[model samples]
Structures are given as structure tokens and as C-alpha cells.
Target: MFSFGLLNLFQLFFLACFCEPAHALAPGSSRVELFKRQNSTVPFEENNGT
Candidate 1:
């Protein structure tokens, strides 16, 4: 049980270290963008403008 706990701790530590670079350079990543689209049609709106 102790070994399992130790392994889990090491895994968590490795993940924390691995993710550091992502957050450090997050602002410069061009693939990241923010956009919003608005749909004005009501839920019950008819398909044709009848």
C-alpha cells in the first residue's frame, strides 16, 4: 500500500511539472482563440418566412 501511495505522489509531481510549460507559453499560442456566435431565431420559429 505504501508503494502504491508513493507511486501516485510521483505521478502527480510529474504531471505538475509537465504542465508548467503549457501555462508559461499559453498567451503566445496562436491556436487559441475566442469567438461567439449569436442565433436570433426563437425555438418555435417556423423554417419558412410564412
Candidate 2:
């Protein structure tokens, strides 16, 4: 029982370590995608205006 608990703790620790970076980057990546989309649309708008 104690070993099982220890194993669960280790798994949780590893999961947190692995997920931390992905979770941290998720927002930044989404922001970059939004920025890219905005930049791409600006050219289209200007072309339409011309």
C-alpha cells in the first residue's frame, strides 16, 4: 500500500514536470497564432482597399 502511494506520487510529479512547460507555452503559442493571423489579414485588407 505504501509503495502504491509512492508510485502514485512519483507519477504525479512526473506528470506535473512534463505538463508544466506545455501549459506555460500554450498561452504564448496561442498569442503568437493570433498575432500571425492578424498580420496575415492586414495584407488582405490593404490589397482589397487598393
Candidate 3:
């Protein structure tokens, strides 16, 4: 019974480690999209200037 509890704890730990990065990556991808949009628009503004 104690070993089962330990196994569950380890599973939870591994799940947390994997899920933590995926959660962070969700926002990280949005941040990258915003950065890409800013970069893409800067060229449009420059083209308008010319």
C-alpha cells in the first residue's frame, strides 16, 4: 500500500514536470506570434514610408 502511494506520487511528479513546460509553451507561442506580427508590420510601415 505504501509502495502504491509512492508510485502515485512519482507519477504526479512526472506529470507536473511535463505539463509545466507545455503550459508555459502555450503562452510562449502567443508571445512569439505577437513578435512575428510586430516584425511583419514594421516592413509594411517602411514600405509605406518609401
The best candidate by TM-score is 3
**Position 35, candidate 2: lDDT:** 71
The positional error of residue 30 in candidate 2, measured at the CA in angstroms, is: 9.1
lDDT of each: 0.65, 0.75, 0.75
Judging by TM-score, tell me the better candidate of 1 and 3: 3
Full ranking by TM-score: 3, 1, 2
Q: Model 2, 29-49: lDDT tens per residue?
A: 766666767888464343365
In model 2, where is the ten-residue run with the lowest total lDDT?
41-50
- Candidate 3, pairs of clashing residues: none
Q: Estimate each model's TM-score.
A: 0.51, 0.49, 0.53
| Per-residue lDDT value at 26 in model 1 | 79
Question: Which pairs of residues have clashing backbones in candidate 1?
Answer: none
lDDT of 3 by residue, 1-50 (tens): 99999999999999999997686568547666666678884643433655
TM-score of model 3 (CA atoms): 0.53
Per-residue CA lDDT of candidate 1, range 1-50, in tens?
99999999999999999998787657645333221113334344444978
Candidate 3 overall lDDT versus native: 0.75
